[model samples]
Target: MDPRYFFFILFTLPTLLFGQINENGIKGYFSFDICEAVDTTDVIFSDYGGGVSGNIIRQAGAMNCVMDCSIRGNSFSMNGLDEQIVFFSGFQSVFNTSDFSIGFYFRPDPGVTKMNLFTKAEMCADSASFTIDYNPSSNQIEATLAQNSSIRTKVTGKLDPDRCWQHVTFVRDDRNSILYINGEQADLATASTRINAKNSSVLVLGSNLCIDRFRGLIDEIAIYDRAINANDVDDLFFHPEEIINRDTTIFLGGSVQIALSKNCADSYQWSPNAEINDATVAEPLISPTATATYQVDMISSDCTAKDEIMITVLDPDDLDCTEVFFPKAFTPNSDNLNDFFRINNPYTIDELISFEILDRWGSRVFFTDNPFEGWDGNFDGQVVNPGVLLYRVRFVCKGVEQTQVGSLTLIR
Candidate 1:
């Protein structure tokens, strides 16, 4: 066995070191590969700390096991029927803690109906018990942390079988007791005190007593005395080595391209439906006139993951739109150009406070509050005689208000 194949096998992603103990404070590790363990009972399950050697026992009979190297190199396979693996009176103090983390990778077979993944309890009572289990009916992984049986914090998302080969981690600390799936935090909340498995005389995996046998491949199971951060679990989930955040800044009317990585996801959905060039593709061009947050949901065969990028559109503050070239001609005859006495390029302006046109006698012939709209050679649905029109305009620029007076001729 090569020294680099420690922890069953090293699964690297783009030059990243996976399963580093000093980085995460790992205490107990179970890589169920017979070729990796030095001392074992019939070369079955071995611990990273060389302690699975003493915690081996059989309840009904020995479970027929096999080595599978398809996922992350190698894993222990179980038949979800009458197979059981019991542990002696060990692994008690390893789990007794107020803050701890348990992480592993597993793929469940269809025969696995309902079973607890990891636990150290005497019976059905939930007090000194810490366990993480799967519920087929809900299609979710639930965590019970030193629970009272009735109250447990749980986070659920649909786990289709195609996405079954996933990494899972559970943690309980002073601030939060969280469950992470595929490096994404999963538990929704059922909090309890520190676990009390110190006096538990029996411990087990795959199944308990006579039933609840798991049918799947499990690899790189670990127990830590301290809580690990989301990044640690993310590495366990085979997350990309680089931070996925693609946040950027842009001036008003400026656009940027954002893209998603193509590692394992099959489909994606982006939100708000604003100024995206192509919403269905892995990359899209966005040009927002205002600051906006864009959300994208990535769906794989087994799980759904989400991420977001905020586009900080440059503020239109301090922008001056006070200049308007009032045409000195007329033509409501509708030839399109210079047809109405209007402000040139009103679209460049942010807001129009007031715009009014008066006759020579100071009588208001046309009144408007829109910069784009102007007098169409009409006063109250009546065509006024062609003459010089007096106008007053007030507009806002960068939150500042300014006024301008101008005159124009209206031609028929």
Candidate 2:
């Protein structure tokens, strides 16, 4: 047996934030950490609380996988030759054609070409299998769910191979199937036919029936019985450090609103909850007397990530703190991408007295007192034309009333 040619399969969970992934619709959760030698046979367990576990069939003489541990922990290392993990139980509901989601983290080997990341197909026509493959040559992810080769739904998305671990999720919401790479929608396809994989068939990771095996470290394999929404996908794909960039200062006794990029988590816990108006919410207003680190534990489905911001309370007399950031431009075309004119960092302002927008003719087009509230490019029940608009904002920063005038381009 070539020591480097042996496969390792683990049935234990890694050190998650709270515990194992406890998502409601999760049918199968495989945390490929901690290897156990069981009668010279490697086994894999679907550890979604009380889900059924299965033995994993591996290629001959594959070494016990324990290399390049990413954030998700120990992973199965495939040699791209023949090593694969075969799970043949409790995976039928996971391949629901109507609404389902499947995700996993993988770090591909350098220069890997066409290789299968997941497959659950049998020789039988009624087996109705699904497979996710990565093709580095085209830099795309090709996926297919089929009742047979003749009746299938195919989808592909851009997949740029990175040296670090990357997340990929395929979500089937009704007839639309969206492929998300690292929390963002990479591609979408409408499925013309319904397909579901039968439980009797084996679910194979790292290789397809065509013998195109994967060459990478795969971990945190998960299967959802429902189509996990974009928010859940974001929570799973992004870590806390990747999202929170607020390590800032605040005037003593002044409150600041701290928030995440998206507030879609199931629950939130702000450590040292005192001095915070609402610690359980995604965005919390905090008035701290002393300098301290506030950490928020964001929990969504089976994933948990936490980010902390060190609030350095400073006296207004010792520092010059009277500046408000305004966005130079905004687009209100209703694409849900930057469609509102809002303050960039409203936390710096203690209180926004009024924010007013005026047309070139000095007509009041929009007015609001909330720093978070934005102008929707509407005036007198009609969307205004794209043009440069003047803005006058009155806000209190560090107990000092400040007025700022600026012009922003409104893009249609």
Best of the candidates, lDDT:
2
How big is the RMSD of model 2?
Answer: 12.0
User: Of the candidates shown, which would achieve the greatest TM-score relative to the real structure?
Assistant: 2
Query: What value does the lDDT take at residue 313 in candidate 2?
Result: 88
Compute each candidate's TM-score over C-alphas.
Answer: 0.48, 0.56
lDDT of each: 0.61, 0.70
lDDT per residue (tens digit) for residues 122-227 in model 2: 6535347778988877877888777666656678887543214568999877767788987789888776655554445667777556647888677777777788
**Alpha-carbon runs more than 4 Å astray in model 1:** 1-24, 34-41, 44-47, 50-69, 87-90, 147-162, 188-199, 209-211, 239-412
Please estimate how well model 2 matches the true structure, expressed as its whole-model Cα lDDT: 0.70
RMSD of each: 18.4, 12.0
Considering only N, C-alpha and C atoms within 3 Å, which residue pairs clash in candidate 1? 152-190, 153-189, 153-190, 155-188, 163-302
Local error of candidate 1 at residue 152 (angstroms): 5.5
